[model samples]
Target: MLVQMFDLLATRRDFFVGLLLEHVQISLVSIAIAIVVGGIAGILISEFQRAAKPTLAVVNFLYTIPSISMLGFLIPFSGVGDATAVIALTIYALLPMVRATHTGITNVDPSILEAARGMGGTRMQTLLRVRLPLALPVIMSGIRNMVVMTIALAGIASFIGAGGLGVAIYRGITTNNAAMTMAGSLLIAVLALVVDFVLGFVEKRMGMRSKAAKRTNRRLAVGALVACGVAAACAVVPGMVAGAPATINVATKPMTEQYIMGNMLKDLIEQDTNLKVKVTQGVGSGTSNIEPAMESGDFDLYPEYTGTGWAMVLKKGGTYSEDEFGQLKAGYRKKGLGWVGMYGFGNTYGIAVRSDVAKRYGIKTYSDLAKVTDRLKLGAEADFFERADGYDALCKAYGMRFGSTMQLDIGLKYDALEQGSVDALIIFTTDGKLSHANATVLKDDKGFFPSYECGNVVRTKVLEQHPELRAVLKKLDGTITESDMARMNYQVEEKGEDPEDVAREYLRAKGLLK
Candidate 1:
């Protein structure tokens, strides 16, 4: 496993190393914010002893909220991206930071404080020269804990379009590439360990009671900050300034197929025009997150589906229809959005049953499956259960009454079905696993599912600004059929091919690229 991980590092040095820098930047930013805010609050609470318990209680309550829940709560206010991730991480760091500072400052020897007072030391002088120094070790311990936890948690920053090592981990898991997954996990683990070790050394150095040791401590702090700043700069987004080149920010839903498409979009736009493209892949919850970011101009465009636009974004009621595409277009226009490059494919929802189960039950359609649903266990990704067209809708439409329903990760549902842990699972028609799975796709006989033809959902203002993008974006229109998309997905997910390479090869085969 270690050798495999190293091999992956060798092959994909840029990807892992880039994410490492992003992780560092986010962790450091969160740490810096926590120390400033939390440390100050800690000092105040320590001085006003009456407020100490109450402030700590409030922060402790905040610390108990799950990170995912906190992020979700913050999304509406902060929008998405690095801002939200940093805020959540800083909030989580507060309890430890404040408690440690307060504990350290208040625990200073009374006699020493009295001696400082007797020597005519001012409050500021006592704190700076006497109390803080004594409290440094305890404070450093808290900082060390906060830094390590912040780094580990930063992996989740990718969920809200805040890119970090977590993106690599998510991609590897989705694509069923164990080596890639291990490589990402190992990098994050190594990073946390390295940062912890450095901070630990600094903590010990700060504890030494001598002029040389104090100078060394200052040097270590500056050195650590400089090194981290350099690492972070390496992964920061291409700088945008008053005179910078025109740039397009593209977003993608969290899926292997979208990653391939995102890279393709970047390559095409950059190749055909002067616009620089930045693709942030795997924005969690698809339309729910990305749409808002789009509205706020955090993203200029992304691949979107007709059904998602119809139901999720426009909040249109009733089953979706091809006729409603016009309405969807008009609705998007109201929101200053436009659709282009409708890729020729339908990734509609489907229910797949283990071949053995299908054969035993003679299930070929929703109606047929409904007859025996009560005897079978159903499974689907958590998002599937929440979407309007998902589990409950299907169950009501066909009167399905499963014996049990399991909420599994999108990547694990197929595995669960294959292993006989689940008799049926939901899937997108374009899922790569479907190409070689031992499952039968049951017909949506009731016409319950909606079409999900993928397309570029661009900000209309961008179109007006960069006319060249229109042609480049349209190059993908009607170019890829369902089979083409599924095969591309298969190449990436099953074969573990790089998504950009797969997308590039497909585009070349179609003579859409030089």
Candidate 2:
């Protein structure tokens, strides 16, 4: 484990540093936001004795809501990424700081406050000199608490594509890699400890030094003004640039069949047509990313599963046939989206076991696996834990429970399964490892998983303006099959080949490109 840690640190130094940086950035921003908002809230609560109890109760209640759910609630407004994470962390950081601020400011010696007022200090002057100075040590304690809470919450924020050390931790937990998990946890712990220690020292020194107080206040005032000015400028500038290169933006989840298809389409369209293309990888699983990006006009085109589109994007509540093209077309139309074209293959979900394990257990079908369920171990992606038709449904259907199980991210499932750490895994049928490692996918006799046909879910406007994109993509629609997709995924994911080069080579070999 030590060797693995050193190796990961050496090889992934940049990634670890980036994670640590994001960790600090999120924590600092959250603490700052909390201090501003919570301090004001504390002040308001302090002024009115009658309102104090209710206000504290509300802020305290907010602290009880799970951080991940809070993030999900903010997803619609903020969308995914750093903005959502920062906002969530700020809210989480508010409770402790608010309580501490209210306690600190209100608890200042009433006699001192009276003396300041008698000395001709105005209300603001009294606040700045007597109340604030006396409250500094306690407020610093609150700030310290906020910092720790924000650091912890930062990891959960990675679920919404907010990159941080949490990504590594989530990947480790899902993939069942103890080394990676410990690495992420250790790094976060170290960061939090270092920050807390440094801040504590600063607080102790500030308590002793009367001369440093005024200078610190001046610096803070200037910093706040500069930040406000920068924010005002950013608000005036539009998020999207006009007359920029006309490009199609594709969003997709990591290590899925749709991700591969999205990459392929980007290459095909850019090479064959006079259009620019960019792909945002790992946007989140299912239709989590599709609707928001399309509605916000952040993305132009991306691949989505037929069933996911039918249920999530369309808001239709029922299952559809595997080859229900008409239903899919109608659904997309109703949702104000366009289906550019469909891939020939359906990336179905299946339970895969190592070939040796399959033989040992006589597990040929989904039912067969149930016989030896008590002796086997199962692994699934992180999202699978909450998915409607995922682990919960699969286990219920099979009437089986395992001796040990782990929730892994989709990206790391293959590696964990291949290493024999997990006996059975929830995997996509088109996963590269099914063929690469000779894994056996048990037959689902009950047909639990619906067909996940790969296709471009393009914004209606993009399709109308660039009708040629539809035609370009349609040319290669049925050319790639399940096996072909698996191989291509392996080429990029396993063999370390660039996805764009893999797509180009596939297109060239198929005579689709000159």
Top candidate by lDDT: 1
lDDT of each: 0.88, 0.75
Q: What tens digits encode model 1's per-residue C-alpha lDDT throughout 75-99?
A: 9999989999999999999999999
Which residues of candidate 1, in runs, are more than 4 Å off?
218-243
Residue 111, model 2, lDDT: 94
By TM-score, who's the top model here?
1
Pairs in clash, predicted candidate 1: none
lDDT of 2 by residue, 1-514 (tens): 8887777778778868877877777677777888899998887776666888998899888889987678878888988777888888888888888888788889999999899999999988987778878888888998897887678778876677676788677655433346666888888888888889978867765666566775885676688689867855664465356755577877766554554566678777877788888665555554675577677776777777787676556655445466676877887776678776777877877888888999987889999998898898899866666666667667787797788899776767777878888988888877765677657888998777777787777888888888788788788678879888888877755564545567778878998767
